[model samples]
Target: MLEPGLYEQTISRELKDELESEKDELVSELRKIDDAEAPKILAEYVAEVAESALARISESGKDSLENQIQLTNKMIGALDSPSDLVGDSHQLLYLVPKVMHQIRGKSERDTLRPETPMSQSSLFTGSRHEPSMGSELKKEIASADRIDMLVSFIKWPGLRIILPELREFSERGGKLRVITTSYIGATDVKAIDELSELPNAEVKVSYDTRGTRLHAKAYVFYRKTGFTTAYVGSSNLSNPAITSGLEWNVKVAQRELPDTMAKIRATFESYWESNDFEPYDKSQHDRFVEAVKRERGDKTPSDLVYFF
Candidate 1:
């Protein structure tokens, strides 16, 4: 819908021909999706495509999009003929999605979020989550608008400290996505099962990350204060790791480290959409837990049960 040819032709006052070409492709897709599920599928497609499109735009492009939308709203306010705004100025993007969902025989809330390109100084002092041993991580979690964590394993006791805060965040419409491992005696299955039960949270498990190039720990928090914060280091999703463990993780601010954040987000998405990880399963989790325990029982203390 935003092909460069449209703008070029508009400048030449020959927009009709180029616009028809673009519409042809879109119309073909629309006709093929003319089923009972069309609305839902279209809504979902728009959300996913918009996310990718907006994120790929440069900082100046994002500013232009926001400015255009805002300017349109300001002009809209002066219109005395029709002042019945369906959605607020900030949520104008959701109106069409909402209508499509209603036509699809479903109701889906939560519009596609438009992210502001961020860049800020790195938040690491000699490879640590905070400057010292402060509660920077906890504060980050508490202050986030959304939380995305990927760890090798999750320990319930360690998760307990932040569980309350996470629950609160979820209740307030924040999302939590956790990707952890379920390798032989490496990650606890019970931990994975526990995390899958939280509100507004989903968990993905890599049953065996042995030779799959997995071992990376990162926590991405999209804050309401206009900054995207992510931590990349050696910490897992265990209590000791989150609380007092001496792990080395570096914090990257999107504004200062936009490329780093982009790469990190891209990497996480690759794993997330791959066969290496899947939705947390209970029966399979039980079996995996048993196998992990049996494996650990048969191993010596010095033996490495799990390795990245």
Candidate 2:
């Protein structure tokens, strides 16, 4: 039995052959018409066939399937007969196999059935993306066009490891937005200052140094061609966090993931606007650096040191 709300149906070879025969007849009729509008009529016919074949189909929106059908038909029609196709037997006949193949392909695709589908994942443990943190984190970061990060702390050495790639990313007009905190001595002033100097980038910091409670660590990467990804968990913007540590981060994609990308974006924007945080600038950088220096002068508390 099929899982809940998931169904798969395969078009029989007989039905496909029948559709091919019908397409051939349609082409013959177009040739016999000898009318300028015959190509337009063929377009209408393809759309009609697709609508009827995928009558019960639906996708992203209510009319997504219908729109795909109409678009495919129009594309096929344009490619088949760009100009004065009527009475041209060669062009008319050329559309037969093309139309048949195109429509059949659409029918197979619009079924909303997986090619090698998984019904669900292991909810008790692990994540939607396989393997563990560091590797997947780097892979997703390299693929994205925009990087939005939120962590309570950031260290310059940590960012330096990825600095070369981030520079290339900035040169290509990739954007960077970060929201970190000065609550602990955990954050490095050099990290914030260096990141602020990059092109198309902004870094913000919260100065709530006493019991800040802003301990959310997430990296949301927005890619150009595919779904956005966000790695959310215990990892922070530090050397051990990105490279190696017993961090519990998991990778998630927009389409398959449960509104994770949207929530991350929203959360970051909200913190970005809040009064507790200010843009990481020269003055803020200097002030934070001085504060860290004094905090280090006395004795470094264990909390000031990095932890998992």
lDDT of 1 by residue, 229-296 (tens): 88888767665565556666677887666668889889888988988887875656776677567646
lDDT tens per residue, model 2, 1-308: 11233322233466456546676344321124337866655655655666665554544567765565565556557777545323322321112257656766665433322111121211111343444344445555555689988987777767776676677667779998888876646778888888888888888887766645588888887866455667677877777666655567655666554455677788788888988888887777677876666545655656466542
C-alpha lDDT (0 to 100) for residue 295 of candidate 2: 43
lDDT for predicted candidate 1 compared with the true structure: 0.63
Highest TM-score among the candidates is held by which one?
2
lDDT of each: 0.63, 0.63
How far off is residue 76 in model 2, in Å?
Answer: 21
Would you estimate the TM-scores of all the predictions? 0.54, 0.55
Q: If candidate 1 were superposed on the true structure by all CA atoms, what would the RMSD be?
A: 14.1
Which runs in model 2 stand beyond 4 Å of their true positions?
1-132, 293-303, 306-308
Deviation (Å) of 190 in candidate 1: 2.8
